[model samples]
Target chain A: MTGHPQSSMPGQKISIQASQLGKTYEHPAGSVVALRDLSFQVHAGEFFCVLGPSGCGKSTLLHLLSGLESPSTGAVTIKPTSVGMVFQEHALFPWMTLERNLSFILDQQAPAQQAANRQLARRWLQKVGLEKFQHAYPHQVSGGMRQRAAVARSFAVQPALLLMDEPFVHLDYQTRMQLQQMLLTLWQEVGCSVVFVTHDIEEAVLLADRLMIMSRHPGTAKTVLQNDLPRPRHLLDLKTNARFIDLVEQSIGVIRDELQAVD
Target chain B: MRMKDFAIRTLAPLGAFLLWELCSRSGLLDARFFPPPSIILYHLIMISPGEGIFRDIGASLSRIVLGYSAGCGAGIATGMVMGLSRRTRDLLYPLVAMLYPIPKIAVLPLIMLIFGIGEMSKIMVVFIGSFFLVLINTLHGVVGIARIHHQVARVYRISRRAYLRHVVLPGAAPAIFAGLKLAIGYSLVIVVAAEFSGADAGIGYLIWQSWETFSLKSMYAGLFVIALLGALFAYALEWLERRLIPWRDDRDTREHHDA
Candidate 1:
């Protein structure tokens, strides 16, 4: 399914374009296909969520889009100058304190304006509600805090495209919701295109402007669903919305069938 | 909070020393042979600080610093090359395996013949002794870095420098530190042994001289100093490890059944 373009011009609307993206891994058993002939476009400043079962190549697609991994076949082209990524594991540098982790990325930029970079990092940390924990190491913080710090670090770099691979998978329900809201708020504030991968249908419904569901083993996009939910969505309000539940149930049904086929 | 833990931890060493003093005073143990902690301390103090002990410590420490630094530098470089590239790993792994088992100390005479009975021989011995442990540890550390980290760096289009700084170093830190700690310990062992064999100055030389003269108290004092130096070295590495890789402690507890 396709929705109305948010912008009039093609150049303005498209942020990322993937053509026939595919990835295959060689194992002792034989070649395992993760993605095959996957193609999609993510619009600028839009939150796009890829929904799939556990073994599906949803995360693989995210990696390829972020240039983290090379696709065996096909290509992903991004209009953005650079891509920022948040991993499922939080991938926070254990050796660095939260502030230093952000600074490390900032330090990569031309060394002339380090003070400005540090200020930007501090601002990002504050945006993520982690200002108090800036000095804390990743190990010292809670799982949710660590993920928030990871997100903050990614955002501090100001990449035009953000890739999130199940970034909230490790958090408890309440923390996940809080982080989901924070992510949406941050995305709105930054106005950068985001491609988020997740197994949770509710999370996708709550966060994504458009959701793409995929089948497992040799993953391919099965359906793309556009959500007409209003912006500035509250977590409680989304849960109570009938359209949200219907979309979630519909996605869940597709995933269930995909799981059965795999079994 | 941590200070209390530190005090409690010191209790065991204090108790051991107390037991040693009591046993020696009661004549249950030969003070001449074992030397009570107090007597050893007194002997160490009565000896002129500049006579030879300080010189020996200085000489031994310099050799260790030089040898360990060189070995660690080479080991880390070799390890990264082998770990990152399949070709290098294939070429070097077999050679390392073959040489690793050959006790480095066994080649001391050969080393002495080649480098002579000078500081070079002693330093080379320490280098060989330390290099293997560091190399193996570094190799394993680099190899063990999670593939996901590499992917993350790739996603960011991280430059080679950034990749090494962020992905490689942090990922391999725990293993590298483990190897470093082991290499430092091996350095101490080999350096002392090398000194014992032929050194004109060093704590090891002092021990040998005392033994020849049947100065049992002085020998025990030298032995005690050696043990103290070894423990101090190990403790210093542990402190550095804690400071440099704080995350390792947390990761260790989470990954292992025993923290």
Candidate 2:
């Protein structure tokens, strides 16, 4: 389901670099620290997953990267352009059909080149196996299908950096696996960089080229694991590998300990 | 199944009309004051299409259309400003609160003095009555749009115009439509009342004239016309709702079907 070759290749080295990034919320009582002096780098064409316990500001990091919120301190920079984000909730415009949602991103581009944009969107929709459901409204489709459409929309613009915040957290296990496979296929086809934030250790280990686990609230990077798994990985084969399960268990263990310490 | 549901709905009205006719004919009711459906229908049929009655219907319909459109437009505009801006809310809330409690009909005489006893006065009365309800509802609707949706729009880097077009309007549409539906009912009621008091050519005027002439059947005919018009307007809005917000209907259908 691959389309034409990349129009322009991304740069080598760090595509996105964050240094001393921090976010604090000022409440009526006082300030609550969400992230403090957090720094990370995502290379171009890499699947980087940020895994942590709930309330660990993993989503906060993603939000900062997505330009949804400003950091309290420090800076984050990406070479090419702003990042495209996929929310945990499939933030599809409920007013629009799936095709129209994709068209919206393309429409934001130059108007005179719309025919080309439409063709690009159609290619991406087919890449996600949503060609049959292009005319369907978001509400009319299943949750997994909606998320796939969301992915298609985010990638349709060929963003330099893609940020996903626990996008498959709400789906059933089977649907989540299927979508994970679809996502990998799309990423391979497009060669776009992704910064996915998830609480699921299995999801993190299965999809990420490099997985970074975060500590408790006022989050900081505890460990960064570079997954040396082979490319064009199959989900079923990846699951059967002992190394995959070991990685998942180790990350889950870290998260559980963090939860207990918080309690 | 659909036909069965339709028949079941029609049964109640049909039975009530039959009972009314039977009661009037059996001398169980005062026929002078309480004319049966048969007499009302007779007068309705007897009234010529080109006669003054149709002209009265036209006048009443026109006044309602004008007043309701004005009220809805002004109300939505003002309400959006008030709801979206803290300064506007502070400036207008006190005045709205003070005026909301006063029955619009209570100021009919004052309105007549200001706008005169012509159509202007009646339409002004209707507008005032309808506007406040629509404004308050629309304000609440605007205020009720989830903050999270605005955040999503911000993340997308949607331009201000695109944000309003894609997010705010759709998010607030259900509430706005709800308000409009209520405002439509208010307009129908107020317009008739205003027409009843002074207008010379409206359904309400015809009703008053019939009452003066002691023609109960003709009065009931006018009342019937008013009811039909009100129901028609409501149905029309519902049709618009189905068309404009089809997603809402689809969501509801899927939810119930899944359940």
- DockQ numbers for every candidate? 0.47, 0.55
- For model 1, how does the per-residue alpha-carbon lDDT over B16-127 read when each residue is reduced to its tens digit? 9999999998999987777788887887878625446788878888899999999988888888888889999999999999998888789999999999999999989888
lDDT of 2 by residue, A120-228 (tens): 7788889889899888888888888888988888888878788899999999999999999988988888788899999888899999988888886577777778797
- Candidate 1 Cα lDDT to native: 0.83
* Candidate 2 lDDT by residue in tens digits, B94-184: 9999998798888988999999999998888778877898888888877888765676567656677776677777777888899899888
Model 2 alpha-carbon drift over 4 Å, by segment:
A1-12, B1-9, B48-51
Q: Residue B218 in model 2: shift from native, Å?
A: 1.9
lDDT of 1 by residue, A111-211 (tens): 57788887888888898888998888777778888899889988888888898999998788999999999998888999998999998889999999989
**What DockQ results for candidate 2?**
0.55
lDDT of each: 0.83, 0.82
TM-score of each predicted structure versus truth: 0.89, 0.92
Error of 1 at A132 (Å): 1.3
Report lDDT (Cα) of residue B71, candidate 2.
87
Q: Give the share of true interchain contacts found in each model.
A: 0.50, 0.42
Instruction: Indicate the docking level reached by candidate 1.
Output: acceptable
The TM-score of candidate 1 is 0.89
